[model samples]
Target chain A: MKLTILGCYAATPRTFTNPTSQILDIKNRLFLIDCGEGTQVQLRKNKIRFSKINHIFISHLHGDHFFGLVGLVSTFTLLNRTTDLHIYGPKGIKEIIKLQLRLSNSRTNYGLFFHELESPESEIIFEDEKVLVKTIPLKHRVYTNGFLFQEKIGDRKLNLDAVQNYEIESCYYQKIKNGKDITLEDGRIIENDKLTFDPVPAKNYAFCSDTVYNEAMLPIIENVDILYHESTFLQSEGNLAKKTLHSTAKEAATIALKANAKQLILGHYSTRYESIELFKEEAETIFPEVLLADDGKSFEF
Target chain B: MKLTILGCYAATPRTFTNPTSQILDIKNRLFLIDCGEGTQVQLRKNKIRFSKINHIFISHLHGDHFFGLVGLVSTFTLLNRTTDLHIYGPKGIKEIIKLQLRLSNSRTNYGLFFHELESPESEIIFEDEKVLVKTIPLKHRVYTNGFLFQEKIGDRKLNLDAVQNYEIESCYYQKIKNGKDITLEDGRIIENDKLTFDPVPAKNYAFCSDTVYNEAMLPIIENVDILYHESTFLQSEGNLAKKTLHSTAKEAATIALKANAKQLILGHYSTRYESIELFKEEAETIFPEVLLADDGKSFEF
Candidate 1:
């Protein structure tokens, strides 16, 4: 799995900094999360193909989180995109987007679909044979949701030497990889585990942002391979963070530590800070694996 | 008067090229015209004070012409702007902007007003003591209208030597500047022309874009000081320009020549061209003073 941070700042976008937006590539499928203003330009800077983005997930209705959505959608029509595009966001997303398209008299050549979420509980929003996506309700001033992306386990690896020793035909290799026992011509059955090796483990990633310190989502993101949490303020501004319903760096680290996530990624920094390294220093006090997110940065696992 | 080309290309924004957006500074009042995507960043890059822009005029409902407007409005709120903002655009502009603001639950502290235009004839939309703005109807695929900005004539300049020789009092200087004759204590009348010289001639600028090669607006923009017209293609692709309802470089120059404009600026270029100098060359073939509009370039008249 690979993740690219297109923009990871807070509030308004500036010349040197952008708001929240990221790209996640899992199981060779690209998923866009939280498109802020100037996201299309950011995508071009990162060299990510606009055509590869089939699914876009918005965290909330805040301008910082999803303001660039309409522009991106309009650009798709200008580029003559034909692939189906799916959007998952809060309930009002469809109305806002549809209004702009109608007023501009723009019609997409591709199939456009919206999956509006209003549930306050953790529920699977997307699932396929290779991947699963669930929403983790977040505590914020607005109706917000953070998504959890999990890659499904793949088929078991084939033990070529063992299969050849058993004189099994090549056509039966598919069944063996599916974890089925093979039978010889004499009707004697062989165990499935003895013929194949174990498959590689799957990975899970959780994205959380623009929320206050809340332990309610800990259980939902427990043992996640990677966790991206918002750290809009530092510990020195803890009071301000709470007053604004935003989490501080230390608070995000505490949540990551309590959830037992393998690594923690801190983002959505306020532009008032002189350096982002302060957030990393504050987060490292509680979490051992802490990483800072900047625009155009990428991580692979 | 000064004009800044924040972005002048056509269609979707790219990494190096931007869509249609510009800043017109006339009579010391900043007016934003046609805000495209990334215009906020462009404003920052151009070192323009955002607070100075209180009026925005959009030429059409195309995405490239006004996609960045909502973001700019939201950013103004984030910056705690208290000044009123006025927008002049097509009839559906208010509905689109109000819908996004409603869905996001954003209430501006400043007054926001929209002046929707559906007129098919020339009319004055805005008039102040210092300036006048009128709509110049154009032929395009949509209900597009170009704007004509004219600086009102100022008071006549005082000839200090001539006024002092005529023994005019300081209190009467204001009257003299207003083009009034002065009567001396000796009962001798002094003509206004002897006391003061004429004021600088009023300058007029016309912005025409996203329109075909039509001369319907020539009378409205006659003898304009500067004219900025859309040149989406060169003369080689004039047929394609006709089909798309866009103007070629030669056509833009033709309009400027027929209107007796002092200078012509060609902008809104299609990205298919390798260089922009070709546009200036083609336009100069028809008009004497042809300027090219490039991103970040500025013009003073």
Candidate 2:
């Protein structure tokens, strides 16, 4: 899985930065995450294939988060897209998109589906053969959800040395890779573990933003392979973060540490801060595996 | 009054150019006309004062016409605007904005008023002491209205020669300028026209885009000071223009000439055209005063 940061600023679009928007590549599927205003332009700037996006997960309804959604949907219609698209967001998203479509008299040719989250409960909204997506109920000024993406268990890997040592027939290698115990022509039974290796552990990505530090979510996001938490302010501006229902670099790192995430990506910095080096330094004190998200930067997981 | 063209391309937001968005400065009012996807950046590039624009006039629901509106409004709120802002557009515009606000759970401290147009009739939507705005009924794919902004009739101007040579008293000059016959201190009665000239002919500016060449509007826009009409295609693409309910450059020029406008400003070029010089050249064949609408270029009326 790879993650692309299109924009990561908080309140409004700045001269040098953009509002919230990101694209994540998981299991060969493109998932647009938290689309904000100017998202299409960001997509173009980052060279992301716009039509390949099959699923969109919106964190909340803040103008900074989903205002670009209507325009994007409309652009899709204009571009004559026919692929099915799914949107997972809060309840009001349907009304917003529908109203714009109604006003414009636009009927999208593609099959557009909406899965709105109403309850603050952890519920899986999407599941395919390769991945599963669940919502992370968050505490915010409004009803908002963070998302967790977990890759499905992959196919087992065949152990060449072990298979040869066990004298397994070549025709039985496929069965062994499928984690099955197989019998050879000599009436010798080869155990699954001896003939095959365990599949790699599934990778997980958790996205949490526009929320205060809630230790309650630690269990939900625990052991995530990669975690992206919005650190809107620096540690010195902790009071401002509290006032705005945002998190500081230290708090984001604390969440990452408590969740046992292998790596933490901190972003959504307030426009007040000139440089992000201080944020990385502060977060490193609590979690050493920390990186800052910059616009157009891509992370492969 | 002055008009600045921010962008006019039809379909997509390009790296070198942009989609539909323009600025009209009338006296003290700065009106944003048809905001497309990258209007904020366009405004920044043009060095236009974003906050000074208190009113946005959207011609229709087409994404090419007004896709950037929500972003601009959100930027205003983030900028901590305290003045009331007004939006005029098609019927569904209010709900589109309100639903986004509801989802984000954000309410503005200042008033956000929407004057949604529903009836397909020409009517005055905005008026002040200096300017009067009336909608021009148009035929399009969706419910749309072109705007006609006319400067209000002002107090009569004092004929300098008559005021000085006729020895008119300063106190009586005011009455004569009001188009009333006045008596001088010498007991001589003077006709209103003899003492004062007519007030500056109310400058009228008609703006129309995203509409076909509907000659029905000639009466409303006849003999205007300036006319801005969409030139989405050249004559070679006339068939496409008809299919899309758009106008060619020659068609736009014909409408301008028929309306007896002083000058014709053409924009909203189709992406197929590499350069807009052909548009100007075609338009000038019918109306020699035609000018291409380049982004950031300003026209004084």
Best candidate (score: TM-score): 1
On DockQ, the leading prediction is 1
User: Per-residue lDDT tens digits of candidate 1, residues A47-110?
Assistant: 9999999999999988889988988999999889999999999998998888778777778899
Scored against the true structure, residue A100 in model 2 reaches a CA lDDT of 77
lDDT of 2: 0.87
User: Number of backbone collisions per candidate, in order?
Assistant: 0, 0
Clashing pairs in 1: none
Tell how far residue B194 is off in model 1, in angstroms: 0.7
Kept native contacts, as fractions per model, are 0.68, 0.63
Docking class of 1: medium
Q: Candidate 1, residue B198: CA error in Å? A: 0.9
Cα lDDT tens digits, model 2, A19-80, are 88989899998999998877888898888888899899999888788877887888788889
Model 1, span B41-97: residue lDDT tens: 899999999999999999998889998888899999988999999999999999888
Cα interface RMSD of each candidate: 1.2, 1.6
